[model samples]
Target: MAEIIGVIEQLWRYPVKSTGGERLDSVEVDERGLAGDRLYAVRDSAGKLGSGKNTRRFRRMDGLLRLSSRLGHRLDGPELFDPLGRPVADPTAFLRAYLQRPDVALAREDAVSHFDQLPVSVLTTATLDWVRGAAPAAVVDVRRFRPNILLRTPPGTPPFVEDGWFGREGGGGARLAFVRASERCAMTTVAQPGLPHAPEILKAIIQAHEGRLDALAEVVTPGRLSVGDELSLN
Candidate 1:
C-alpha cells in the first residue's frame, strides 16, 4: 500500500561539507545524491577532512555553517552563498579566515567530502516542531541538522513520523528506499549561520528520540526531485 502524506518542503544541497547549503526549487537525484551535494569540502594540510562533526580537525567548522554553497546544473559551476543569499566569489580564503587555518584547502569529496552516514537524509516539520517544543531555549534551525530533504508533514501529523517510513519506498521524482533512522552526532550542536551555538539541541533529540532525528535512505532508482512534489511511502 502506498500513502501520500505530504508535499516536499525544500530540497537542500551542501556543496561543501559542514559549510552552508542552498535550497533548490528542483534537483536531479543521482546515485551520489543531488548532482552537486557535498561534492566538495575543505581539507587541511594533514589530509584531515573539514566538518562540523570533525571538530578535532577544523576546530571551527561551526563558523563555516555561516557560509553556504550553491551550484548550477553543471557541477563545475559551483558558487558559495552568504547568509543574506548573496554569492561569494572566493569561498576558499573566506572559509580559511573563519577556520583560522591557512593550510586548509578546498577539495572535492572524491578524496574526502565528509559524508557521515547514508547518501540521502530526510526530516519532517512534525519532528522539527517536536524538537522545538522539547528545547525552547535553543534555536531549532533545520540548517543545524543539515538534512538533504525536508518534508512538510500533513497537518496534525505526530512528531517522529519519519521513523515509520523506514523500509518503505519514498520520493516523487526520485525513487528511494528508506533504510534506517539517522543517528545524531555532535555536529547538530554546532553553531550554523543565523543560528547560535546550542549544545542542548542534541540533548533534545536524545531525550525525545534516543539520539535519532531523521531517516536515511539510498536511491533505489535514480530520478529527480523538486520542491512542492509529493512523496509516497509504500
Candidate 2:
C-alpha cells in the first residue's frame, strides 16, 4: 500500500551545470532525470568541467552561479544569459573574458556526466524551515540547494523528514527512489542574483546534519511531473 506524503511545490531545471536554473510549472523526467537538466557545462582546455569545487573531474570556476541558462528553441543546446537576463551572443568568448580563463569554453556533456552525484535532488519545506531556524540571519532560498523537486509536506512535519524516505519509490506521474542525503558545499553560500553570499548557511547545515541537507534520488520511471502533484511512498 502506498501512503500520501506531500505535493510537488516547485520544480527546477538546470540547462547548464553550476549555473542558475529556471523554474517550471511542469517537467519531463527521463532515465537521466530532468530532460534538459545539466545538458551543457563549462569545460576547460584540460578537459575538466567547471564547478564550485576542484576535483579530478571538476575545476573550481568562480562566477558560474552568476550566469543562467535556458533551453533554446533551435534545439542546438542551451543558451547562456548574463546575470541581468541578457542573452550571451558568444558564450565561449563571454565566459573566457568574464572568467579571465582564455582556455575555458562551454561544451555539452558527452561520455562524462555533468552531474556532481545523483541525477535528481529532492528537498522539503520542513527542511528549509529547519535551516532558517539554525541560521536565523541567512537566506534559506531553495536556489541555494539546487534541488530538482521541492516537496511541500503537510503542516507540523519535522525537519529532515525526507531522510526516512531513502530507498523508497514514490511520485505521482513519475517514479523516483531516494538514494542518499545530499551533501552541502560552498556553492550553497555563493551569491547569485537575488541571493546573498552567506557562508553561515553551509555552516549551519554542517553542524546540524553533518553537511547533508536534502535527498538525492534516481528516476525509476520516466513521465511528466507538475506542481501540486501528490507524492506517495511505496
Candidate 3:
C-alpha cells in the first residue's frame, strides 16, 4: 500500500526558459513534463542559450527575471509578458530593451524542453522552511527555487524529506526518480519582485544542505497533476 506523504501546494509552468514563470491551479503532465513548460529560450547573437545561471556559454540573463509568458498560438509559441505583467506581441524586441541586448532573440525549443537537467522538479514546504530558519533575515519565497511543483508535506515531516523519495512512485501512476539534489546558484540569490537580494540565503543552503534546496524528477508514468493531489512513495 502507498502511504500518503503530502499534497501538491502549488503548480507552475515556465513557458519560456530562464524567465519568471506563472502559477497554475492544475496542469497536464506529459512525458516531456508540464505542458508549455520551457518551450521557448533566449538565443544570443552566437546562438548561445540565455540561462539564469552564469554557466559558461549559457550567459546569466537576470533581466528576464521580471518577465513571464503564456501559451499563445501552438504554431507561433509563447506570448511573453512584460515586467509589469503586460503582454507584448514582439517578445524579442521587448526583451532586448529589458536586457539591453539587441543581439538576443527569443526562439522555440527544438525537440525538448530547455530544462537545466530533468524536465520536472519538486520542492517540499519543509525544505523552504529550512531555508527560512537558516536565513531568517532574508525573504524566503518559492519563486527563487523555480520548481514545477511545490508540495506541502504533512506536519512534523522533517526538512529534506524529498531526498528520500528517489526511485519512488507517487499519486496514482506518476513515477519519479530523483536525478540528484538540485545545485544552488547565484540565481536564487538575485532579487526579483517581492524577493530581496540575499547572498546569505544561498550561503545557508551551501553550509547546511550542500547548496541544494530541491530535487529534480523524471516522469516514468505520465498523468495529470493538480494542486490538491497527494503524493506517495511506492
lDDT tens digits, residue span 69-154, model 3: 77732536887888778899888888788889999999887753477878888999989998889999999899999999999987
How should the candidates be ordered by lDDT, best one leading? 2, 3, 1
Q: Please report, in order, the local distance difference test score of every candidate based on alpha carbons.
A: 0.80, 0.91, 0.81
Residue by residue across 156-194, what tens digits does model 2's lDDT show? Answer: 999999899997998889999888998889999999999
Identify the leading candidate in terms of TM-score. 2
Give the TM-scores of the predictions, in the order they appear: 0.89, 0.97, 0.93
Residue 229 miss distance in model 2 (angstroms): 0.6
Which parts of model 2 are misplaced by more than 4 Å?
72-75
Writing each residue's lDDT as its tens digit, candidate 1 over 1-234 gives: 779867889889888877778778888999878788888877888777776554444433446666777776679846877666687778778667767889887777664436667889999998888888888999888887788888998889999898888878877898998889888877788766667788888887888788998889999888988888999987
Sliding window of 10 residues with minimal summed lDDT for model 3: 169-178
Off by over 4 Å in 3: 72-76, 111-113
